[model samples]
Target: MSAHRSLSWLFTLGLLATLPVAFAGGIRGTGDLGLVIERTTGSVRILETSGNRFLARVEGLGDLSHASVVYSRDQRYAYVFGRDGGLTRVDMLEARVDRRVVQAGNSIGGAISQDGSLVAVSNYEPGGVRVFDAATLEPVADLPATFGDGRRSKVVGLVDAPGNRFVFSLWEAGEIRVADLSDRANIVVTRYEGIGVNPYDALVTPDGRYYIAGLFGEPGLAVLDLWHPGEGVRRILSDYGPGDEPLPVYKMPHLEGWAVAGGRAFVPAVGAHELLVVDLESWDPVARIPLQGQPVFAIARPDGRHVWVNFALPDNDRVQVIDTESLAVVSELEPGPGVLHMEFEPRGEEVWLSVRDENRVLVYDTDSLAVLTELEAATPSGIFFTARAHRTGL
Candidate 1:
C-alpha cells in the first residue's frame, strides 16, 4: 500500500475510537425518568420529566390493577409490584424489565429496605411476607402472618423502617408485626397483637420513628413508636368516628397519603366528606375540614405550603387544594374524571396527576395552579418518579 493510504487508515481508526465515548454521553440519566402504571393494559409508560415527554412503554407486567413501585437507591432501577404477585425489576435507563418473578398468588404492595439491599412484599393469598434480594430478585426469607387459630391472616401496609426492618399489619388478626432483617443469619420477628380491628393500611412517618395504622373495622388509628417498641401499640382518635348516619364509603383512604406539614398531619376521613388534621405532638384531632366527597388521597407538596386532595366516585372528578397555614381549601379544580393518583416533583414546583378516565396525565404548576402539560396515557393509575428512591417510606 502507498504511504498516504496507510496514514489515512490510521486516522480513521483513531476517530472510530472516540465515537463511542461521544455517543455514551448522550444517554440520559435516570434521575429525571419516571414510570406511569397502565392498569387496563398491564404495561408501564416510562417518562422523561425534564422534557415532559414519553419515552417507552414496557408491557406484559401482569395484572397492574393494584400496582405499586419502589425504586433502587441508585435511582436506575424500579421494582414494580403487581396485584397478580408479579414482582418486576425495571431498568429505567434501558426502559425495559430487567428481571421479574411471581412470588405469591396475590400480592398487595412492597417496600425497599433502608440500605436498598432487600425488597419485601405483603401477600393476601397465602397470608405472608416475602423478602427478596434487591439485585437478583431471589427469595431471601418468608415470614407468614399466622394467627391464634393456626390460620394465616392477610398482610397489609408493609413498609421499610430505618434499621433495615420491615413493619406490616395483619388485616384479619388485627395485629402489627416487625421483622428485623439487618442480620440474615439471625432474623428477629416481633408481633404486637390487638392493634385495631381490620387495620386496612399504614404509613411510617418520614423520620421513620412512628408507624401508624388506619383501622377499617372501626374509626380509630393504631400508633407504634419504633424508638420504643416495648410500649407496644396505642389507639388514637378513638372517638373521632362519624356519628350515626355516616355516608357510605366509596373507597378506602390511603394512609400513605397522610400529609405531615407544620407539626401536624392531614389525613382523609373514611366514610365521610372531611379531612382530619391531627397535632403530631399529641396525636389528637385538631380540626376537621369538610370536603366535596369521600376523600381518598390527601397529599402535601414538598414545601408543605399546600395540600392537594382527591375524592372517590361522585366527587372523583374534582381536586381540592388546601392552604397549610389556614387549614382551609383555597382552590378546587375539576381536572376531568377518574383522578386516581398524584405525585409532586422533587422540588415541589410541579405536580403530576393521573386522570384514568380521560387517559392522560396532567402536570400542574404549584404556584399558579395552572395546567402546564398534558400527556396521553392508557388508563394511568400510579405516577411514580425516581425521586422516591431517596425517601424513607415512599
Candidate 2:
C-alpha cells in the first residue's frame, strides 16, 4: 500500500474510535429513569422520563396495593415496599429483581438509609418496623411498635435521617419513635409518646431536622425535633378542623404528599377540601387553599414554585395545580379516573402521573398543563423517579 493511503487509513480508524458506541436497546442515565407501580398485578414498569418511553417491566412482587419505593444512592437499585410486607430490591440498570423477602404479614411502605446501606419497612399486620441489609436483604433488626399496655401498634411514616437513624410513627399508640441504626447490630430506640391520637403518616424535612406525623384521631399534626429530642413533640394545626362534627374521611391523607417549597410546607387537610400552607420556619399556619375534594398527595415540583395535588375516591379523577407564590389553585386537570400518584421530573419541567382506572401513566408539561404523552400500565399507582436517590428524605 502507498504511504499516503496507509496514513489516511490509520487516521480514519482513530476518528471512529473517538465516536460514542451505541449499546444494545439504548443507553440510559439515572436521570432518565423512573418506575410505575402496577399495584394489582404486582409489577413495576421502568420508564425513560425524558421521552415518556416505556423501557421494561418487572413482575412477581406481591400485594402492592399501597406501594412505595426508594432508590439507592447510585440510583442503580430500587427498594419496593408492598402492602403484603414484601420488600423487593430491583436492579434499575438491569431491570430485574436482585433480591426479595416477605418480611411481614403487611407493610405500608419503606425508606432507604441515607448511606444506602439499609432498607427499612414499616409494617401493619405484625405492627413494627424491620431493617434489612440493602444489598442482601438480610434481616438486621426488628423494632415492634409496642405501647405501654404491651399492645402492638401499626407502624407508619418511616423515614431515614442523616445520622443513620430511622424515624417512624405508631398508629394505635400515637407516638413517634426514632431508631438509631448507627450500630446496626445494637439498635438504639427512642420513643416520644403522646404526640397525638392515631398518627397515620409522617415525613422528615428535606434538611433532616424535623419529623412531622399527621394525626388521624385528631385534627392536628405531631411535629418532632430530631435535632433536639429534648424539645419533645408539639401539635400544630390543632384548630384547623371545621368543628365538632368534622366531615367524613373517606380516605386517609398521606403526609408523603406533603411538600416543602420556598420555606413553606403544603400539607393535606384531613376530612376537608383544603390544603394547609404552613410556614416551615415558624411552624405557623399561613393559609388554607380550598380544593375540589379530599386531597391525597400534595407534591411540589422540584423548582418549588408549584405544587400538584390529587384527590380521594369520588374526586380521584382530577388533579389541581397550586401556585406557591400566590397560594392558589392555578389550574385543574382531569387526566383520568383513579389518579393514584404523581412524580415530577428532576428539573420540574414535566410530571408523570398514574391513572389507575384508565390503566395509563400520563406525562405533562409543568408550565402549560398540557399532556406530553402517555404509556399503558396495569393498575398503576405510584410513579417514582430515580432522581429521588440524591434527595435527603425520599
Index of the highest-lDDT prediction: 1
Evaluate residue 258 in candidate 1 and report its C-alpha lDDT on the 0 to 100 scale. Answer: 35
Colliding residue pairs in candidate 1:
none
> Each model's TM-score, in the order given?
0.93, 0.93
Predicted structure 2: clash tally: 0
* TM-score between model 2 and native: 0.93
Q: In model 2, where do residues sit more than 4 Å from their true spots?
A: 1-23
Model 2 superposed RMSD (Cα): 5.3
In order, candidate lDDTs are 0.89, 0.87
lDDT of 1: 0.89
Model 1 Cα lDDT, one tens digit per residue, 107-159: 99999999999999999989989999999999999999999989999999999
Give the per-residue lDDT of model 2 (tens digit) for 262-360.
Answer: 988899988889999888889899999999999988899988999999999799999999999999899999998999889999888999999998899
Candidate 2, residue 51: lDDT: 62
